[model samples]
Target: MPLSLLLSLLAPPLCLACGAAAQVHQPLCGRCRGGLRWLPPEQAGAGVPLWAAVSYEGPARALVRALKFRGAVALADAMAAQMAANAPPGLLESRALVPVPMHPARRRRRGFNQAKEIAAALGRRCGLPLADCLERPAGAARGSQVGLGREERLSALTGSVRFRRGAAVPLRALLVDDVVTTGATFAACAVALAHAGVRDVGGIAYARTPGR
Candidate 1:
């Protein structure tokens, strides 16, 4: 066995996928790594090139669940590290990061926007600014759960999100989120940004549900 492999065999690593105490990277174990479905650039997205750091399995699922359901803001940094490692180098061009916004009512109940929190963390790591360029309707929701077709998703939030009120116009942006189940949501966000006259919209997420 190679010296490194032999050492790993002797030491055994903790399962990074599930926090199981082993001896390797405390977060990602060899088994979990093997199971992770890291996508090639072709599968990420044709127009935007979706960037994902790890497969949504083992610890990755747990981490996303913990962050989303368990209110784990602390996990953002670790997640951001993964983004730093895997995100496209061009993602941070002249554009800043803008996380998909949650409805005010939902955000009020949750006390935070998880996507925004993640974008903030990633923005810090990438040394870029963040912009809240879009908003959901007063009582509407935008996501896979919303049950809207792609065309509807494009204009669903039309009146909801105000245009870029900031001094900057003709800016570029990268939208962020925890997971993308369908291309609908991201495409819709792109539509909204386009309506607002902003060019150059790309996206990044922690995970993507396979297939439509």
Candidate 2:
């Protein structure tokens, strides 16, 4: 933990969603995790199968908002753990966990990549290496993830997220992210992996949409 973050925890910041004092250095209170909805990967639609740890409502939603919008990088661990909780057996046994990358401009404006943070945290706890799966170039940075059709958006998104070419090793990967609304982002990352000769890529995330 950063010195500033460590000091902040000693004092204990008040939770935004609830008035309770947060014991964890991250954004959530103990009660919050309970209110969050969790989904397993196999329950998802036809696409890159996703493992969602919590729902997008209640405390999980609040925590995700705090991390993605309020610049709270510290909350990644909670999300990572929750995500790992319901991850596929294949992912748990995999050697690498790759984060779906954000465009540079958006990342710069946000001041952090929540997916990357979650990916690193997941890798640490799961004892796997964290890999970078996608990189949005100079132009493609913005989109309404909600409006896009799962298949269409997945088809249009980052198809060429280059990893190190010609590195010699067996390839079994698990994609990591903060959440999945449409299957778009997960599918995009899956496509990238497929291009890289990784035929089967599993996914894990903080949470997933309940329907569709």
**Top lDDT model:** 2
Regions more than 4 Å wrong, model 2: 1-10, 88-90, 158-170
Cα lDDT tens digits for candidate 2, 61-102: 777787899787777887777666666666677557777787
Clash pairs, candidate 1, are: 12-23, 13-23, 13-24, 14-22, 14-23, 14-24, 16-27, 16-28, 16-29, 17-59
Error of 2 at 124 (Å): 1.0
For residue 39, give model 2's deviation from the true position in Å: 1.7
**Model 1 lDDT, residue 63, Cα:** 68
Worst 10 residues of 1 by lDDT: 40-49
TM-score (all chains, Cα) for each model: 0.75, 0.84
Clashing pairs in 2: 37-55
- What are the clash counts of all predictions, listed in order? 10, 1
